[model samples]
Target: MNVLKPLSGSTLALLACMAAGALCGLVAEPAGALAYLFGQLYLAVVNMAAMPLLVVATFFGLRQVCELPRPAWRVGTIGALALGLMVLCGVAGTLAGALAMPGAHLPEHAYATFGERLLQSAGDAQEVGVTLFDGADAAVSQTSAYGWREAVPDNFYRVLAQGHPLGILAGTLLFGLAFAALSREQTSMLGNVFEGVYRTLEIIIERANLLIPVLAFGTAAWVSAHTPPAMLAAMGSFLVCFLACAAVLGGAATALTARRAGLPLVQIVASLKAPLLVGLTSGSATASIPHTIEAMSARLGFSRGIVELIVPFGAVFVRAGSALYFSLATVFVANLYDRPLGAGDFAVIAFASVGAAFLSSGKSGVATVGYMGVVLSLLQLPAEAASVLFVTIDLICEGPRNVVSLLAVCAVIALVSAGLPSERVMPEPLRAQPQVRAPLRFALSRGQLALVAGCAMTVASLIVLMGIGVGAK
Candidate 1:
């Protein structure tokens, strides 16, 4: 009965739908289109609840943070670590892209065709120009200087309506602070109300999450039926490199966190399976919040207060996966155009990519594409074609990206828990009966499992590259 949980059902459904969608896409275009529409509808349903959930959860989370001992230092330490990890992701992605050289062998005609299509789509008459080793002069001149004005919303309602998450986050934090400053009686009443709201939204999101398999089916069908083989082939190098990086980084992060927490790697992985699978298949880390909180507190024995405080905040702000993809995609586009990059250009890319990653939305690929434009524009690069190209394969890449993001959050949870006193951490509940550990012929722990999986993926990627010949047209 325990094995028959919602997460297991969802995972099985997702895998089945993906396979069915792929088959339908290959065999019948109309059927695939229908499935794709269903997926879009599911995405819309879940997205409807996403922002509200974030608002309520974050409000309560920040309120709790304010109650922590030395709250300022705790917040600062977590923020710094999150930001540092994002920067590392960006740097790693850039290095991988450079080594893979995704578009180095792109056919001239194909490049011209893509560029022409992009220009046509944008209705732009400007001649496409190419230059080598251009410094940050163009980027500096073209980029909008960041200021407090951009961070602060002009109208709270407009920001919320427009789904500007960062603005909402800012507004919520301020509101939480004000609530905290109230008299104890007033604060208690408001806290109860906020908790009620958070729980209600959490319930709504959980129900909405049951629709993920339908979403996966449609996305897989649409992507398979509509994306041309040539475009997919063109994206092969980038995809391989991106997935490889994700696997390695995610695995390493998970292992380190597990070891630091003094938990059996297998137990941690087992507990996290549901949220991880949901995140990967749904391509939305926010959708997995309920499961993440459960895994952290109920399963891994983290303090509920800390888990609640960190996960919501991390879901919105700590997007290591998005940062990685942005850096990699920028490099891919540069390679496609034979653009020579310098140390300064990479620095700008790192800065822009990390900045944009913080602003990534958890709903769908559309917001991601829009954000990529800002990053490209900051580098004074033409974004029209690159945006279209990336969006074409965004569905395929999104799952792994979400997985990486979730893993980062888990790592943060472990680190934060480690710093807390033992009394702050919760003890595991007593089971109805003593659970037996089954001995295996080859006993590989969860951390070792992660390492093995990562190494396997790396080897597979290399073999595929060699077999296909990276220069293949």
Candidate 2:
């Protein structure tokens, strides 16, 4: 049995902010520019925290794994489970698109609307002396540049510096394994350093979370104001179809977890609400890491070590959410282009989708959508117009995607982590507990100062970029 509480205050506030922002944006679109600045600043901070969190978390998870009995088997089992589920998710999404036929039977009004949108886009492109498909052409031509080397890079430092997720994941995984394999005498100082960094970063994120509601409001306003309402209406079927698949995938995962954990569904929801809300609002699992770990371990009665291992690792490499997105988007594009989809086409789409989903990690917005073009090119579909509509109204789409991804984490843990939580440690909630005494503090370590500097520089640069955009207007 689990002891998860009801939805936390922050979760409710985030939802309210998003709703308010949507309504406000629909009514007062003029504030969008201001909102964009706030939204970017918030995301930039999250981005700043992400890489360091990844390294520290990888250390924690891998060290825990190595301590567990039969560590190699546990790692292999988790990998196989994640990979298989992601593949099935891709196939399921493609099947939903095929059955729904969202893009095939567009209303007459939608046809006119889509035609005008394309013409306007083409006009804009022509004014700049480039075709609408030029980007896709250049993109397809560069496909050869990505390969196994990029996935498991030899130049770890270069890729780490560039903030590539796959490279970071590979490098940190190997580093953590080596660290865990070393004698405690040899690794104690570095282990303590990693633990301190993780704790410090957690505190930093907790403090920064005060801006989440404002970020939600700004992000909602920014999306609503920029995207045409009519465009959303015109493609409502695709949105609905995507949402339906997400519901199926998410519901199944939740139900399975509840059944296996012997916990009631309401209790499961109570435990997960915070992380799920954060995921939906921020669309960054890294931002939800602390909430996710506590909820799964302390509230939902799973192993903290296992929860930590899966959340970050699964967020980076598993990518069931991206698999679903790629599969459905590919099928929708095929239908939109009037390309015939054969049995073989579905097979190709499924496999390509899984691969593309893995490759699209660490990317967001337009960069994430660009992977859809790779699948489209393989099937000879017109990729240009297909993505334009999706991009225009992606904010709504991303919430479901992020939520599904988070649920996938829980689902894996529930299925694979079957033991009871006998060794769980319950601490007072961070807000409820007050510090007994202030510790004697010295000046910041050089490493800590460097981290603070990096975060400050990242946020400042993004704000400056936002200002440049505002000035151009």
C-alpha lDDT values of all predictions? 0.74, 0.77
Candidate 2: which stretches are off by over 4 Å?
1-12, 125-141, 144-147, 420-473
Q: lDDT of model 2 at residue 209?
A: 56
lDDT of 1 at 463: 97
- The residue-level lDDT of candidate 2 at 221 comes to 84
Question: Which lDDT tens digits does candidate 2 get at residues 177-255?
Answer: 8988888899889989988998888777665555666667877887777777778888888888899899999988899
| Candidate 2 root-mean-square deviation in Å | 21.9
Clashing pairs in 1: none
